[model samples]
Target: MTDNGPAGGMIGKVAVVTGGGGALGGATATLLAARGASVVVADWNLESAETRAKAIVAAGGTAVAVGGDVADDDAVERIFSTATEAFGGVDIFHNNAAAVHLARSDGPVADLTDEVWDGTMDIGLRGAFLCCRTVIPLMIARGGGAIVNTSSIQALIGDTWVPAYSAAKAGLLSLTRSIATQYGRQGIRCNAVCPGLIPGVRTEPDMLERILRRQPVGRSGRPEDIAEAVAFLASDAAGFITGQALVVDGGLTGHMPTYGDPVTSPLDAPAAR
Candidate 1:
């Protein structure tokens, strides 16, 4: 059943957002904290994470920042340990951390180098695994909790350059399903969000161009949009939803590749444009 209360949207909860200094992660943390959840902004960039936490605290929301390398098992453990020790057990984990090299950025399969592929997979997929491994027991022990892993549309489609990133995100989708299948009876829920054309710091221009060319909405997604979705999945409102991959791409994926009529294509139709 769906819960409809003020606290239905993550109020009085505790949340950890990995890579919280970045646009998407920061947005999730801020939104959760704003709704009365104690947010931990964990990132490899310590200063940025602490700064974000400070901003949240200054705005009268509860927050703390911790630093760790997502690719390192020990670092992941310490991050969770800090969360439990500082604010009690974790009620929500936004497993949003990822690493992709701009030089070898999203591309065709043949161009991927061993170093780039391995590094990207290590952080994007393995790091997500490590976080879930560490947090699932705590969540089960505390009764139940929600996890939302950040994936990308690239996982399903290969229009981009980074093969490793796409593969890693695809793995995350399967991982979400596994968690849901294994622990749904215990009240643990896991899901993934496949965001499209989000405005990353260095990729904003490219992202904007893509949205303009193909996105039906004529704009790229904001981090706030994904954050709102995460908040819902973390809250009791989405108690019945699990192992779902919600694509927040403004109907981009729902439409046909070229539609029935290329000349009158919804994306390229002159008057519509």
Candidate 2:
């Protein structure tokens, strides 16, 4: 067991992170553990989850690995049950699991299959719903807690491919607001972290290059970038923040859509007298 220190904002909190084995999720899980929160690293891949949990333990933090799919109701129960049994109850929940495989199968709405669409929504959106439903009562019982859903920049923009993924992420933002408004009176806060292209994690090389050019930062986002945002929102440091979608895309969505077009490039225009 890890001791709750005075300096950590998450001291004594218990957090459940779905997809905690992935790059972004693992980073968030590690950071949360470092901040004095006992973490439950739940993931569909048991070995991956164990690897993350062991790393935290080696670092003198408290954590456990649970193998399960967030979309399954039974698995969702097992996830929180592990948190409750191991650390008493949940004080934070990070809904970060996603159906990344959808990228291979996703296409324009006209060519999209039911299987692909269902797969995306089931894991991306429904999974979040299941987690929120399961953890809210536990959080309320503990007097309050934080929820940070992992949305995507696609949620706020139009894309030719991956229509289902985009829709699910957009749906998540709506759910975030609903949860915050309905449960804020009970001290339960919910929000989302919309990430831009993080190289090697989600975006393809060609797509990454195109998006990176449009991003004002001129670089792909790091897993730590999103992780830090999640940690802050999940901690008391962001106690006043709720029902909001914090976009961590390095200003990818803050500018005009035609920013990278050569014809519209201000840098290429003739200098004014």
Candidate 3:
């Protein structure tokens, strides 16, 4: 990193990361803490959040864990309260929490039930609504703040299983824009990162090899890949950018599928490390 590094202006800032218990969220929370931000790791799973918080603290970074459902307005308030009591006002917020049951009910919209649809929206859409509603004022009060929301590649595509997941993420993109436009004058900026297939590549490379070979980048995306994007969007570097949905899918969405897999593709010769 240069004198003005990747996390410029993040030092001493307070950040709240919803879903910090998960792979991408935990990685983002850790990265922010390492860059001199005090982070509150909020998650529905109390123990998961606590574990991540402990690891951050152990690594000489500042972090605390708050456990509750992000979809609950009361729980959302508690999250903000914890952030305030721990590190003053919120300066950076990463809305990354979500829920879905893909193995059981996620399918074509016609095949999906109320439970699957409602559950997905409750966390993905409603949860984002509550967090943004609560964080916007805090951000304004603090003079300025950055909000990085986790949208998905699913939102922009047609082929997919989780219909509710796609709809909720599409809603997230719209919500991101609304916040950015409405609060740009109030010193608040909001943006979303639409990450492609993620989370399993690290632990299930063998099983994911086929899908990994399809990415134009010649590899599967890592959680840190998304985390780094979140860090950039939440940093001073992106001060002038907002209301944008950045596609961080290693060019996976950049093709028309005619980049046909030749014999030289990663599938034929194991994906390059």
Candidate 4:
């Protein structure tokens, strides 16, 4: 059909990317379209989505912008409905939206308020669930599809001051496995891309430096790094990869940190110096 041999595996596919206005999300949406997938760049901010969609069009890719809150059931439904109407059927869904700044509402377990927890879960956890529920049927109707959840390294380790954020991301891993196992026979693939130390646009220089020092790779992650991993999971290139949490953090979580201590001779190193 529309497949352009090996690389353009997504030639005739339709992709849905939530939070498509964000840095990482926008990169992912663009790359998918570049690889021959028609993308729906859905975001809560209409202007931002339009900007990303326009960029794709300028690059000779097919894309449309849709504005809607991922946490709102009605909005999510409208997002999918628009995609189906314009693109025919859904083949890939990237659930990337989250109320990340809502972390201000979080604190220690004792200080965690119901309001904060509710808002965090609603945006980070429930949003992905809502998108998946709406799109899975579309995938089924189209025979099969792929879903990529944007998880975090925080889910696998202890982080201070953001219990709610940690909990929400952990939920995504469970959701990934559940959907993959349950729908594997039906050709629905679910996977996660966990990023670490990806500094935001507003990240302070000092904070970014600290993140770079902590990361084993000696550098902070870029939006394109996450985009490439997402493309792999969504395309037939990763057909056998499912229900796995692929960490694309430049070796951030590869091993336990020893703070530069010599592995062989912690005591002898001081004496030799």
Q: How many clashes show up per model? A: 4, 0, 0, 0
Compose the digit string of candidate 1's lDDT tens values, residues 1-273.
Answer: 112334365666789999999888999888888888888899999998999999988988889999998889999998999889988899899999998444346466786678788888889999999999999998988898999999989888866566788889999999999999999998899999998877665675755775656667766789998988888888888888999998988767867767434576765666642
lDDT of 2 by residue, 166-205 (tens): 9999999999999999999999999999998888755668
TM-score of each model, paired residue for residue: 0.90, 0.95, 0.91, 0.92
Model 2 residue 5 CA deviation in Å: 12
Inter-residue clash pairs, candidate 4? none
Give a tens-digit lDDT track for model 4, residues 142-221. Answer: 89999999999888989776889889999999999999999988999999999887788657798777667557787779
Q: What 10-residue stretch in candidate 4 is worst by lDDT? A: 1-10
* Native-to-model Cα distance after best TM-score fit, residue 155 in candidate 2, in Å: 0.7
Window of ten residues with lowest summed lDDT in model 1: 1-10
**TM-score of predicted structure 1:** 0.90
Q: Whole-model Cα lDDT per candidate?
A: 0.85, 0.91, 0.88, 0.88
Candidate whose lDDT is highest = 2
| Candidate 1 C-alpha error for residue 207, in Å | 5.2
Better of 1 and 3 by TM-score: 3
